[model samples]
Target: MIKGMGLSLIDSLDTMLIMNLTNYYKHARDYLAETLSWDRDIIVSVFETNIRCVGGLLAAYDMTQDEFFLKSAVDLGDRLLNAFQTPTGLPRTTVNLKTGAATNPSWTQQSSLLAEIGTLQIEFSYLSYASKQPRFAQKAMAVYDHLLTLMPEDKLLPIFINPDDGKPKGTDLVSVGALGDSYFEYLFKYWLITKKASRWGKEYFETVESILNTLAFKIVDQDEEMWYIAERQNKNINHKFDHLACFFGGLLALDAQHAPTEQMRERHMEIGKGIGAFCRKMYTMNPTRLPCDFVNIVGNTISNPIAAGKGWLMRPEAVETWFILYRLTNDTKYQEWGWDYFEAIEKYTKKEYGYTGLRDVTDSQKLEPDDVQQSYFLAETLKYLFLLFSPKDTIPLDKFVFNTEAHPLSFFEAQ
Candidate 1:
């Protein structure tokens, strides 16, 4: 199980880096318009699919110093946040395509949607960072507080929660798929930005690390075989790719303890490499195949190649890992691979929509209807890719590292 600790541990450090990639996102930059076809238009989202079409717009605005992109990103964030204007604090997973308002009464889901809010928080984080607006940070923090209330004792959050009532509406155990990245995204970024262990930050990361430890040994015996969490009652190996979930817990564990035992480091490596290698192998074996749309052990590879776990070669999340790995090794191989994925995605998918993150990239790179274009795909994927390819000096590496708990790792603040 602890196969390549040195390498994987190195790679984990690079996850969700945000130095220069913020600039490379120029092409996919955000822009809102009222064209001939549509009556009203707006920005995209992270809560549900197809909601965030112009996610890269804000990043682009920030990167290029262009007012167009800045307004684009902010406008989109504002549009989505407005939709969550329920009497209750929670937000609907998706909004009206035309009106950009939540026609739904309220959201009952927390795990994935909370993750979504975290992604949105990042956009706001950037808005706050660039403009020094407390409002963006406040909005992002408010969503985090809402999610904090919903997390369970097991440290594994429930799938969905009633935003109106604040009760668990779904299964007891959380899906590693939906909540993992966003959970840590908020945890690490919030800590890095605020540097405060006050309130719930420390407790949040503690729970995240615990849940990830669950994956290191059992569910994923090896790196490649990620099993979906079938039930909260039992979380044993249901061997298959639960791709996003596979990444979730492991990522938190990556930087858990400074100078983590050699063994612990090794486990993280295997997990990272396994995921990368499996994705590579699975895709290589069937070049024409899109990544699995989404797989359940009962019926593996049921969805399109763009599915999770066992799917196509190019994924925002998968490629995002390579960027994380690149930061660790400084190995050109990972950087090279990162470009390869960008090329592959361009080659395989088309741009039906402006925003990119979706489960299935099988068709034209159309953002999925159910898929909310997450701000995270940009924070994690495009940002990492840009960092992978760009000079290290752009973002001042030292500024963005250091967890809220203050894990004294050199990687985030590499010399």
Candidate 2:
């Protein structure tokens, strides 16, 4: 957990940078430099380290113009490269810090999650660009090339892929949720960071259109139209949505403003608003103004059909979407909704140690706390909420693009 706090500190610094809190900036920078120096041999999970450590270092360097941060990022990037030593170039999930040994966990069945492999490109590519080490980006982009070769008939990728051979696992499952979320996210983000001239931009555009045509569906018989993207396995559609998947609405909204054609732009805007409304229901339908980890859409309404996993984990996707929609439309309704959501979290989840996950959001009387706060609660959830209420000039949407983890990266102009 201490290792993960590097991301939180960097995110706090980002907020400070935007607010021009120079005093706080110096404190943060000092603390970050100190933190980066501690425990050089602490083994780290690739995904966690990449998103937080590598991503944080890059963002910090960008904000501070500090060579120390960039040097640390390059060092971390070199250590992380050991995970990519597999035959097919899809990295293992974890790596040792000192020994540089890497391996997938025994339970993973020779396959890695799509999000794990696909999400590395943005940070790794940026590291390559900044550090002038082409190998980092080359290793990362190899995973993308391998995934393209294994694209399904529908062109949307499954959640798991064999790292050894770069093929989709036996399961036909496809989702924009947990195991799949950041794959699509980095696609668009990589395009933006690379200035839209790279293949990533074209892939992002194509994938969004494919998802709209294939994976996205509408809940039937609802008074107001609610569009929900679902997972498919072996021709069976699981009419469920995850809070994490809610990020798509905001992504769609952001992309809509940049769509090439007026028709395409309007279509994206419509989908974004529809998805945003559906996600809002995930909160308004609950007494606690918080959603379970996942919810089912059946016939006419969204339902918590699965009782076992009904919990809220301080996730930011829904609120993140609200922030983007609010930014795009300047609609006070999004702000109102966000404020209400924040109030509920403050009322229920706040604790002496830190905010925690809720075991059940529906039972307002006995909101059992899960007793752990994830780093993303700071890096993403609160950050998005803070940005939502801050002045528009702070991290102007036109000037920067955010990673899946909410770390902002400036657009790269090709030389």
Please provide, for model 1 over 202-241, each residue's C-alpha lDDT reduced to its tens digit, 9 standing for 90 to 100: 6555664565466433233334463233323345444334
Off by over 4 Å in 1: 1-55, 72-74, 96-100, 105-112, 129-133, 179-181, 195-201, 217-237, 245-270, 285-290, 294-314, 332-390, 394-415
Q: What is the C-alpha lDDT profile of model 2 across 182-211, one tens digit per residue? A: 898888878777778777777777888888
The CA lDDT of each predicted structure is 0.46, 0.82
True-vs-predicted CA distance for residue 241, candidate 1, Å: 2.2
Query: Estimated TM-score per prediction?
Result: 0.62, 0.93
Off by over 4 Å in 2: 1-7, 19-25, 38-41, 220-222
lDDT of 2: 0.82
> What would the C-alpha RMSD of candidate 2 be, to one decimal place?
2.1
